[model samples]
Every structure is written in C-alpha cells, then in structure tokens.
Target: MQTWLVQHQKLLSQQLAQGRLAHAILLAGVAGAGKLSLANWLVQVVLCRQVQKNNDQGILSPCNSCKACRLYHQGSYPDFLSVTSDSKNIGVDDIRRISAFVETTAHLGKNKIVLLPMAEKMTTAAANALLKTLEEPGLSCVLILVSDDLDMLLPTITSRCRLYDIRPLSGQALLESLNRGQTQENLFANVSQLPELTDEQVHEQFRQFTARLLDFIIKRQNRGALLALLNENTYAFRWLEYMLVTMARSQYNWLSWSALRVKLVTAEGKSAATGAAPGDAIGQLPDSETIWQIYQLVVGCIKQLKSMVQVNAAYLSEKLLVDIETRLDK
Candidate 1:
C-alpha cells in the first residue's frame, strides 16, 4: 500500500466490485511504481472469501479471518500460482507447468490467480508457450502480469492483457507524501530497479553487478564482471544505459536525475551534456561505436524473439555474447 499506488487499488477494487475485472491484467510502469504490490493486493482481494471495504474510502481489502485469506496468508493457497525463475530467463517448461495449472479447477471453488512478477523475463519459447493460455484465460483464472518494460514482452501477450499504467506521484506531491509518512530508510531508497523495489536480495544482486561494471569501466579492474552475463539478463541493455547515466552524472557532477523518475536535487548546479576531451575519463569512455553495436545486437535479438517465429533463444543470447566480447571487453 505505497502512497503512490493507493488510487490504483481503489480503481481495481471498484472494478472487482462491479464484476468487470479482466481475466488477464497487465500492471505496467517503472521500477518504483509498485506493480508487484498492486498485483499482490488485487490477488488478495480476489482470494478473500469475505472482502471488507474501508469506511473512509470504500476501498476493499482482504478479510484475513476467512479460510481463503488464511490459506493465502500462509503461502499455501492451492488456487494461486506464481511463475518464478532462478536463472535469467523463465523457460518453456515453466510456462507449460503453469498452463497445466491454469487448466485445473480451483481447489477453493473460488477464482484462481497467477502472478508473473517479471513477465518480460520469459524466454521467447516460454512466451510462445504461454500464448495459448493467455488467449483463453477463463473466468476462473486471473492472470496478473507485472512488467517494468512492456517492450520486452511479445505483442500477443501485451495485446491480450487489460493494461493499467501505474505511474508514481512526483515533485512536491511525492516529497510531501513521503515526508509525512517516512518510516525505515530501506523502505524508500529512491532507487529504480523493479527487483530493488520488491526484494532486497535481488536488489543487492543487481547493485553487485553495477559495482563490478563500474570497476571494469572506471578502474579497468574487473571482479568477474562479464558482458556475456548481461546478454542473458532481460534488463541487460537498460542496465547498460543506467550505468552510463550514472557515470555521466558522476563525471559532470549533475544533480543525479533518476531514469526511474524519483527526482532529487542536491548540490545545486548545472550540467551540460558535453563529451570529454580525448584521453579524458569520460571521453575515452562511452565508445559509441561499441555501445551502438551492442545496442543493435540487443534490439535485433529482442525483435527476433518477441515475434511469432520460433527462433532459438539460446542461440540469440550466444550470438549477442560473441558480437559484444571482441568489441566491449578490451
């Protein structure tokens, strides 16, 4: 129930109240937009046998006393399915399993819900495997897709979903709300990675990669930071862009505007987007030719994968690695 997401909850709850919610929902936004939180909230509301509305706002919330709510809270809800992955991509097998689960009847005789926190991380095969399920998600099955980047998902997937764009409050509004209800520091770090907003462990993992990349680029001192691994990550290209922005900010002493949209201004100053001189830290950097090639390789790979043709995802990732290595890791 983050402040910025309260309106979304109310809007979704009102839809549920009217029995007009879609079978498949896509909550699309930036990292700090609370996509997963909103998904979880919607799932709880759907699963609650006795949903209660707040007196002040009329927004519905789960009645935790009911058997269904109890089971869900215990993490043993038979009707709830969350597709997850340990590796960089969710493979075809994972989608097949979920598709089978979707076909089954709900154990509670109520609605079933499937949560895909990183829908965009599904491999090309996995996404294709999921098309049948997405196209025909019955009334009993409520599939909730949470994606920070819609561009990474297949068009068929995005087209089938009832989309909701979850945007955050900004400027004075965000600052005032946060100031009024500030809690722990970790809860509001103002960083923008989807994993960073939801899970601390994953956030740490991403930052570790960022640190290693900084070492590789800034110090030429690598601690096992490989561009090949970025090929496997769904957010690889975005992460590269994020790193460069950070580098640029540090180099020029910019005010550190976040791509995630949590704006902050400190040490007030002006920064022009000017390239550094030859042999300068920022000038010898960027290496536009190499970065552009990397960008092109990624765009090509994504285009091939998200389309209908059954291209080999593994082959694409491998090709990306090969194309970037000679150019990137010098």
Candidate 2:
C-alpha cells in the first residue's frame, strides 16, 4: 500500500471492525491514483476468513494463508466478479450478469465481491439495471465501483453508494515516493506532469517528449523539432494539449501540474548553463486568449484522431504545427 492510502485503509478497517461496512462503495479519484488497487485490497479484507488487526496501529489486513485469500491470489475465486467494458460503453448485459452473480451464494462462505473498474463507462440502461441491486445487495455481497470521473455516473447510482474520494499525495511526498531507488539524474528525468505513472521508463519518456514540445512552443519557431517530436511519439496530441493548458494557466499565474513541470524543465536547462537559480520562465507564455485558441485547435485534432475514418497522423500533426505557428505570428 502507498502512504497515501494508509488513512483510507485505516478508516475502512474501523468500519469493518464495527460491522458497519457499506454494501456498496464508490471509489472516486483521478486516473493512476490507485483507486483500483485500493478496491482490490478492500475486497481481500472482506473475503478473508483470517483478517489480522495490528494492536498498535489498529490496521486491518488479509491473511494470505486463508483459503479465501489463497483462492483470490490464484485468480480462481468463484465468488469474485470483475466487470469491464469491451466497447465504448458497458451495456445492460454487463449489469444483468452482475445481478445474476449477486443472486448466487458465496462459494467460500465469505463475502461475494463484484468490482466494476470503470463504473463511469456504463451506459444509462446498465446504470439503471444496477440501481436495485445496490439498494438491497445480498447479505454477504460487496459491490465496489471505481471511477476516474464520478460526474459521468448517474446521480441515482452515486447516491446509493458510500462515496470515498481518493487524492494524490503532495508534490514533495510524491517525488520522494517515485524517486525511491532512483539516482539524482534519473529522478529529475522521470518527473512528469501526469498525476501518476507507475512505470519509470514510460514516465521519463513522456517527460522528454513534453520537453521537446515545450521547447518548440516557447521558441515560437523550430517547426522541425515539433515535427520530429510528433513523429517519434504516438502521444504527441496529448502532450500538445497538456502544453497548451499549462501555457493558459501560466498566463493567469496559476500553478497546475503541467505548469509546474514546465517550470522545472526550463529551470533545469537554464541552471546548467548560467549557474543561476532556476526561475519561472512559464510566466513568459503567450496571452490567455491565444493559448485558449491553440488549445481548442488541439482539441479538434484529438477528436479527429478518434473518428471512425482513418486519419494520417503525420499530416495532421504537421497541419497543427503550421496552425500553431500562424497563431503565434498573429
């Protein structure tokens, strides 16, 4: 468990100890915040026949040797149901399957757990189908819904479950956590604007890609650099969108994750050459209106990428870079 989840784990432990655990729990947080991990941990606790409680800290944990825990670890737990969407949305059939699972008896004489990893992806009919089961779940059934955006869920679905909001750790804490076992050079290299990235190599690559994109934008030239970066990474559109948003926030003197990342990257480069303290070069970004216009342009390109008809990525990227240069010229 990460340090960020310690408090939530303790709270849920207390509820379990008192036999007051809710039948349905809605775990809400941004992507990569470990909401799914927390839900899985909670399921193990609820299903474990031998749950251990530390007298000193009063933390609850599952005993791995228990039959229920063993089955879960082996991925052969009959009572556990994990639901996910294959298409754009989880249709009513998915919810109906969950309902059927809930109606069955637990095979391990423990709580039957049904986990929906992306609850927000459920269609309206699917959500409606889940309402009645959430209201009156089986005596030993637990439903856990994990969502990156709680607002996308139906009000009736959210209102029926106990909501637990998870948050990212502070910048310093997060840096320390992510930098464990990493050298100083690699530590700074791996810093990212993303809220969370579990893989160090992927994080570092993303940072590098973002840096190149930022260099082109800040210089208001370097069309070649922009094209090179886009050609090398499939996630160029996402990086461009992030850069535009950061520039917009910088104009308002607001410090977003991307804005902070921009400052860090710029400061590192400047400090290496001039021997001066790192400063906020992000404040030199273009005006807010200009940034918004560029952002909308990137947004449109992203939608086009998602269209049914195939679009040439290289051509689209070049066109976007040209449009951005034009905007900067004005």
Candidate 3:
C-alpha cells in the first residue's frame, strides 16, 4: 500500500474502533489510486476478530490465518457482499437485491458489509432505491461505495455517505513503484527481438502507443510537450486514437470531482444569500469546460473512425490540439 493510503486506513480504522464510523463511505479517487485496495483492507479490518483486541492497530494487517479472515479471503463470508455494474449502469434490480441482503441478519453475527464498485454508474432509479436503504440501514450494516464519478450519484446519496477523497500518487512515486528495470534499454527500441513486422504492423503498434500516451497526458498535464507532437503529420492517426483513449480515461476520473464541484457551487449559492460573493464558493479549480471540450472532440473523432468516414486523421488531430491549446491559454 502507498503511504497516503496507509494514513487513511489508520484514520478510518480508528473511527471504526470508536463506533463513530459512518454507515456509508464513499472512496473517491482516480482509477489507479488503489481505492479498491483500501476498500478491501477495510473489509478485513471490519471483519477481523483480532482487530478488536488490538485497539484497531494490529501487526500491520489482519491476522490472515484467522477463521474470519480465511472465510473472507475465500469469498464465503455470508455477511459480506459486493455489487458491480453491468453495461454502463447498475440497474435498480441490483440495488434491490443488495438492499434485501442487508436487511437480513449476519450469519456470523458480524457486521454485514456491502461493497459497491463504480457506485456512480447506478441509474437514477437504482440510486433512489438504494437511498431508502441508506436512509434506514440495518443494525451493524455498513456500505462502502467506490466511484471515479461522484456526479452521477444522487445528491441524497452523497449526503448520506461520508466521503473521503483519495489523491493520486505523484508521478515520480508511481514510476518508482513500477520500477520496470534499472537497465538503460528502452522497452520499445528493441525491434529485432520482436517478431518481424510489416509497414501496416508498425502503424498499428504506433497507434496503440499513441493512444496510451494521449490518455496519460490528458489526465495529468494541462499544456506541455503534446502540443509539439500534434503539429506533425507523421503518426497522426495513432495520436488521435491515443487522445481518444485519454479522453475516455479523463471522463472516468471526472465523476467524483464533478459531483464535489457541484456541491461546492450549491453551497456557494447559499453563502451568496448571506451577502457573501458566490465566486468564493468555487475557488480556483481547473476549467471543467475545457475538460469536456477535449472529451467531446476525441469522442467525435472516435465516432468518425468507427463509421470509416472520409476524414483526414492529421487534420482532426491538429484541430483538437488547437482546441486544447486555446483552453489552456486561459
């Protein structure tokens, strides 16, 4: 586990020990920020019998060999449940089923836990149905909802859950953690060892790398080296594909921030009623309009590619690059 995440775990475990832990918890963070890992750690802490004896601070982890921990690892814990989405949305039926499960007594007389990943993907009807369960949770029942997008979840849902924002690991830290190898050889430079490739083969691989790189930039950078890459005609299609993937990743991570931003705006509006300026409510956050524009432009290009339309990839790539450049200028 990362350092920051470990700190969060310690704080949460303390709250649990004091019986002050909220019935619902929202783990908000970027895609690779280990939100799910922390959630799993929490489940162990909540389910571990030895955790109680140690005052919420055991030897770095739950005694994995214990009967409770063993059952959890094997996925045989009757009181523990997980709900995941299908398609783009988690349907009302899924929420109802989990809700029904929570209403029942725990088989081991332990806390009944419901872990919902991508909680923001729940449809309005589904969210509203789950709201009833949140509004009146069962005794010793806990709900842990993890989402990259908090905006899609109902305001009622947000209010019910105690939200914890998980910040992304710094780039330097992430790279260090990956620690691929100390050797100076570039991962992509060795072509002879790779299978013989034709012109079309090279183009496809170039396209894949371009897509991954674009996704990385959009999520992490405002305006930087990518502008130069966009100006060149060479490998333009691959670049555009990378931008599309990046945009998709951006949209995925924007969910929670969007929800939190809206909440701030609402609170700001209320503050304005008391003679304070509303501008103070929003503060100085990144321009969401630019984010949406980049997302839509990439999405438009993706749709165009899907239809096999007579479009010039270079022209589209340059156009979107200009749009991003303009947005960052402000």
Candidate 4:
C-alpha cells in the first residue's frame, strides 16, 4: 500500500519538516487512484500520539505500529473527522456541523484533521459555508478535500488549497501487488485459465461496445439505442470508461506531436480538413489548442460519470464525439 503512495508521502513529509504545510489540500485524481487512502494516511500522520515532538522534521512520519495508528485503522480516532457521502449532495447543514466541530480542540493528537471526501458533491450553499472556514482555519487545523470531479468544485475553493494530481498505479506496480507471493509461472497459469480471444473477435466486441455507448449519448436523439446496451449490466459503464481513457490518450499523443504538424491518416480514410489524413503529413501536426480543450471536456465527463454525479453519460458521450469530429472538420 505504501509503495503506491511513496511520492505523496515524500512531499507531505517535506512540508511537515519545513513547517510549510498548507492548511488546506485539494487532492485531484481519477477514481481508484487511492485518494481516500492517502487522506487516511495523512490524518494518521497528523494525529499519531507517539510521533516525536522534539524532531520537528521527524514529526512528519507516522509510526504505523503505534496506538494512534491502531485506533485509526479501527476507525475510532477521536480527533479525526471525515465527512462523506450518504446521498447525492452534501448539504449546507453538513458544512455547518463540521464548522461547529472544528471550534473545539483535539481530544487526541496535536492537530485536528477534517477530511471531506467527494468534496465536489457539496452543494453551492454548502461550498459557500465552507469558504468561511477556509478563510480562517483554526490553529492546528488541516483541511483535506478529496475530489475526483475537480470541475464541479468552485474556483475559489480550489484556489485556496494546494492541489495534488494522483494517478493510477503503473502496470508493473499493479502486477507486483497482485502477485506478491505467487511465482511468475503461477501467474501465467492463472491467466491461462481464461479462454483466449482472437483479435478480430475482440475488435468486433469493441466496435459494438462503442456503438452502444454512442447510443447512450444520443438517446434523446435516438432513444432505442440504449435499450440493448442497458439490461442493468455494468459492461456499458466499464466500456465507456475504457474508451474515454483510450481517446484521451490518443488525443494527448496528437497534441504532444502537434509541433511537427504530423498528419496521421487512419486506415478508415478519415482526413483532416486540410486533406492531410492522420498519417499523411508525419512531420506537420497543426496547433493543438482546440484538441486540448476537447481533451479536458472528455476527461471531465469521465470523472463525472465515474463519480455517478452525471446522469446522462450517453448524452455527454455523443456531444463529446460530435465536438471532436467538428474540431477535426470530419
């Protein structure tokens, strides 16, 4: 678990040592990037009783075996406050309750930690109420907000906090985690248990998947398209996520190489407005300002969909695709 969080830990420890820690931190990441886990670790570090007081720099480290760590693991830490979702939106009253709690001193650690998970889900009124607390954070108070949907958060709230963008564990790291005690042969055997799928079959499945996803996006324009895609199954959701990530990566690559004006003509004969197919002008990619905007929008939609904050996945998908096509003049 610590392996996935080593980078964040290092930065946080540096801050604690220098006594330059921000009163509030905003963690932005895709879902499953372990933002909540990092927040929990941070709370433990700030609240651990056995942490050395003499070493200002050393105080950053949390003794995982200490009583404080144990209590935190058990979810009974008195000083650590966590506000999470029970429903769609966090109400103004919730923020008020937190404000009331923050007025008191810590019962355990030297610091008071308030964690707001899915902070973007807080309603407009709730966010406004929290803004007051942010303006005047009490002594020893640390505000940590976890939001996968950074777009939904008010700009004022974001500007007040230092932002950390968390990312997924690399493939090698994931495999190592999954195969800790297992041999390579054993891992291969486990993989081999699944039937092999041919490339064509896989591509066909993906094509149909993309079609159904588009159907969902354009349901208002084409309602019947979503019926076959949605029998209360999770596959539709999973594929949408996969395609969004894939498209985002593709767009990023295009943008990165835009200085060359490299033209990449897909085998499908789709050409850019200038008649340069995707691969036609390999050394002359155009300016990427327009592509970057589309990329951000697509990523925002993905984050909203994953958090279940946006109800119209199909509609958003259709709009995004149309925008992309229009940008390319396809």
Candidate 5:
C-alpha cells in the first residue's frame, strides 16, 4: 500500500473494528489517486474469512490463507461482483444485474461485495435503479462506488452513501511513497530542474504553461512556445487536453477549481477565481462552441499518441496548435 492509503486504511479499519462500516461507500477522487485500490483493499478486509491478530498493534488483520481470501485473490470469488462498462454509459440493465446479484445469498457466508468503478458513467435510468438497491441493501451486502468526477453523479445516489474524499500526495511524499519498493527513474523532469517538486509547484507550472499556450492561440501568434513544451515531454498532450477543458469551463463560468484540482494562475501571478470569465485580451475568448471543437481536436491528438502505430509528436502538436489557433481566429 502507498503511504497515502495507509492513513485511509487505518481509519477504515478502525471503523470496521467498531462495527460502524456503512453498507454503501462512495470513494471520490481524481484519476490516479488510488480510490479503486483502496476500495479493493476494503473489500478484501471484509471478505477475508479468518482474522489474524497483529502482534505489534493487537489489531485484527485479514488472513490471506483462508479460502475466501484465496478465491478473491484468484479473481473467482462468487460473492464478489465487479461492475464496469465498456460502452460510453452504463445502462439500466447493468444496475438490474447488480440488483439480482445482491439479492442472492453470499456463497462464503461472509459479506457480499459489489464494486462499481466509474460510477458517474451510469445513465439517469441506471442511477435511479441503483438507488433502490442502495436504499434496501441487505445486512450482508457492501456496495463500493468509485468516481473521478463526483459532480457528474446524481445527488440522490451520493446522498445515501458514506462519502470518502481521497486526495493526492505532494512531490516529496509521493516520490518517497512510490519509491519504497522500487528504483527511481526520471519523474519530475518535465515540471522542474529539481529532483522533486511539490504538488503546488507542479500545478503552478501547469497553469503557467497553459496560460501561455492560450495566449498564443488567442493572439494567433506562433506556436513555437507550445511546441517547445510539447517537445520536452510526451505527457504535454494530456496537459493540453486538461488546459482546453479548463478554458472551456472558464469561458462558460462553470469552472470547478476544487473538483478539477487545478488553480488557474494568470500571467500576472494572480490566482484567478473559478467563476470569473477569462480576460478579453484577444477581443473575447472563443465561444463555447468553438472551444468544444478545439477541445475535441486536442482529445483526438491525445488518442493518437496511444495508438499502436507510431505518431509524429512534433507534427501532431503543430497541427493541433495551428488548428486551435485557426478556430479562435474565426
């Protein structure tokens, strides 16, 4: 387990020790924050048949040698249901299946666990159907919902569950945690010259890079700066996608800074309010429609980077930057 998860684990284990575990748990956090891992760990603790006593702390722990634990580790646990959708949205049928699974008895005489990853992808009908199950889940059933964007979920669904917000660790902490059992390679090269950078420093760098890119696009200036950033790191495409999304939200005054985990910093080194519209420096910023079009283009470029066929990073970046500039010009 990572250092960030240790604290959460201790809290959750205490809840279990006190017999205060909720029937439904909602793990909310940004992508790569280990919500799913934490959920999995919690489920394992619940499903483990034998409880081993910790000699040091005098606490109970999951015994991995038990039949239940072995089955779960092998991915053949009959009482465990992991629901995920390959389609763009999870439909009512998915929820119905989960409901049926919950209605059945637990095979191991332990708790039945249902894990729903990307719960926000559920459609309205699906969410409504799941609400019924959440309201009346049996005594031995546990439902875990993981979502990267909690705002996208229905309030009714979230209101009934015990919510746990997971946050990412800072640079030195994250590095130390990740490096516990592995060798360290290049991790902070793109963000700074130092070997490590705090989370705030990384976000600040991202904000500045994004602001400069938008300025170039809005002014119809050369994209040499943007290209230079892209050339420095392959992850720049992903950063560009995030910047475009932020800009879209800013233009429509729908920016959720806390949810997005980004602090918009202006070139003047001032923190910009999420509700404020962007500056009118190139006349008006592109309208929402144009922004969406540019955003989609950036998304496509990002997808191309992951294709099995090799893509020319410089060429793609230049094309995407010019296309965005042309759209803003219109």
Candidate 6:
C-alpha cells in the first residue's frame, strides 16, 4: 500500500465495516493519486469469500486462498468485467457491453464487479449509455469508476455515483514522502509519461531534452541545439507539451493538480499570430499565458502529425522553434 493512501484505506475500511459501501463508487483524482489501486483493493475485498484484516490500518484485503481470489488473480473471473480503451475515447459500444454485463447474475453467487478505469474518457454517447446502468445498477453488483479528471466527466454520470475525491500529495509533502528511498520505477509507475519513458536510453533522452528546453526558455539561449534534439525525437512535441504544463503550474506556485487539469482542458487552442506582444520582454522567460500558448501550439503540431495529410514534420518542428524564438523576443 502507498503510505499516502493509508488514511484513505482506513476511511474505506470504516465505511465497509458500517455496511455503507456504495455499489456505484467513483474514485476521482489526478493521474498520480493511486485511485486505481484503491479501486483494485476494493474489488478484491468484494470478491473474496473470506477477507483478511490488516493489523496496521485494520483495512480488509482478499484472502488469496479462496476460489474467487484465485480466479481473480488469474484473470479468469467470469463475474468481473473491465471496460478499457486503447484510443482517446471509450465509445457507446463499450458502454453497451457494460450494460449487458450488469444485467447478468454473478457467477460466484456473490457480488459482480465492474471497473471502468479512466472513466472520464467515455464519449458523449458512452456517458449517456452508462446513465441507464448507473440509474439501475443490478442486484449484487458493484460498479467502480476511476477517473483522473473529474471535470471531463458529465454531471449526470457523477451524480449517480458515490464520489470519493482522492488527492495526491503535492510540494513539500510529496517530496518528503517520496524521498524515503522510493525507486525510480515506483515513482514513474503512475505518471502520465510512462508510455514514452520505456527504457533507460529513452529516459536519459528525455532528461537531456528537458534540460535543453529549460535553457532555451529560462536562459534565453539560441534554439539551434533544442531544434536539433526536437527533430531527432519523434515524441519531442509531447515532451514540450508536458514540460510546459509543469512549468506553467510552477509559475503559479505549483497549482493544484485538479485545477491544472482543468486548465489543460480549457486552455485556448493554437492561434494564427505567433510573435510576442508589444513591450513584452525581449529575452526573459515567458509568463503563464505565453507558456500555455506555446503548449497549445505544440499540441497543434502533434495533431497535424497524426492527421493523414502529407506533412513535412521537420519543417513543422523548425517552424515551432522559430515561432517560440519570435515569441520570446518582442
């Protein structure tokens, strides 16, 4: 168990002891809050015929000896259903399958568990389809919704579920806890950049790229070195978007994770104009607005790359770097 989540686990245990655990549970938090882990623990406890108690927090865990536990651990549990998406959106068809699953009886003659990780990824149609299930979650069934950003989810979807807002430790508290000798793997396990940082080589590549980007932004250095690195790495645009996001948050004294996530969704799109405003500092680091503007520009470049249109990626990359330089100098 993550030490930061020990308190949350205790609260959950208290709720379970009082027999007040909601069937439709929504564990909402930012990316690194470990809400998905909590959802997993709850599902294990629900499926276990015999639950074991933790002496520390008095939290309940599954008895791995049980038949249900064995099946679940083996990924062969018939009563358990998870709706996942490889793409950006979870479509209506996925939600319809969930409805079909909820209409059935539990194979274990106990609780049927359904988990929807990143539930906010559900499309408009998917969210609407899920409303029917949320309104009438069948007998002896538990539906768990794990979301990184609650703002992306529809109000109607959230209203039907019991919400537990699990927050991540930030700033000093985060540093203190993580410094207690946590390994790199454990630290990055729940980060949004996991897919990009696959190996040591890739990790070092990003580390250097981040350093160069800071030099370009804060030190007002030439863009030649940065542009070279950007053109080399196919994922450079995403790295810039991610770094600018962090810098933007730090610019605001490390803004709240939830609040930053909201800004990420609501920030303005790419603009036609690219230069800095009149009277803007010639060589100083940009303000918050400029940081977000550059973020949107990078996102635009990424989108263009994803499209079917014939694009000169190297030209696009150079154009973005040039635009950033132009924006830095009024």
- Candidates 5 and 6 compared: the better one by TM-score is 6
> Where does the lowest 10-residue lDDT sum fall in candidate 1?
264-273
Candidate 3 lDDT tens digits, 1-330? 766687788778778878898889999875546788899888888887776445444323677878888999898978899998655568889999888998888888888889999997777789889988888734578899998656656788989899989875444443354453332112221322111021345444443344333333334342234544544433444445443443344456743433333322322243211223444432332355655666566667656643442346556565766665565455
Candidate 2, poorest ten consecutive residues by summed lDDT: 183-192
Q: Write down the TM-score of every candidate.
A: 0.67, 0.70, 0.57, 0.56, 0.60, 0.66
Across residues 42-161, which tens digit of lDDT does each residue of candidate 5 receive?
888888877665655443567998898898889998999999997667889999999999988888877889999999888888999999988883457889999977887899999999
Which ten-residue region of model 6 has the weakest summed lDDT? Answer: 265-274
lDDT ranking from best candidate downward: 2, 6, 5, 1, 3, 4
What overall lDDT, based on C-alpha atoms, would model 1 receive against the true structure? 0.68
Segments of candidate 2 deviating more than 4 angstroms: 137-139, 176-198, 208-240, 248-289, 297-330
Please identify model 5 stretches exceeding 4 Å from their true place: 53-61, 137-139, 171-238, 241-325, 328-330
Position 39, candidate 3: lDDT: 92
* 31-71 per-residue lDDT for model 4 (tens digits): 55678888876777777766543454333557767877888
Q: Write the per-residue lDDT of candidate 6 for residues 160-237, one digit (tens) a residue.
A: 889998866654455456563343333233345543333466666666676577668766664787889887874577
Q: What's the lDDT for candidate 4? A: 0.61
Flag the better candidate by lDDT, 5 or 6.
Answer: 6
Best TM-score among the predictions, by candidate number: 2
C-alpha RMSD of each candidate structure in angstroms: 7.5, 6.9, 17.7, 11.8, 12.0, 10.6
The residue ranges of model 1 lying beyond 4 angstroms of the native Cα positions read: 123-125, 135-139, 170-177, 180-211, 223-239, 246-330
**lDDT scores in order:** 0.68, 0.74, 0.62, 0.61, 0.71, 0.73
* TM-score for candidate 3, residues paired by index: 0.57
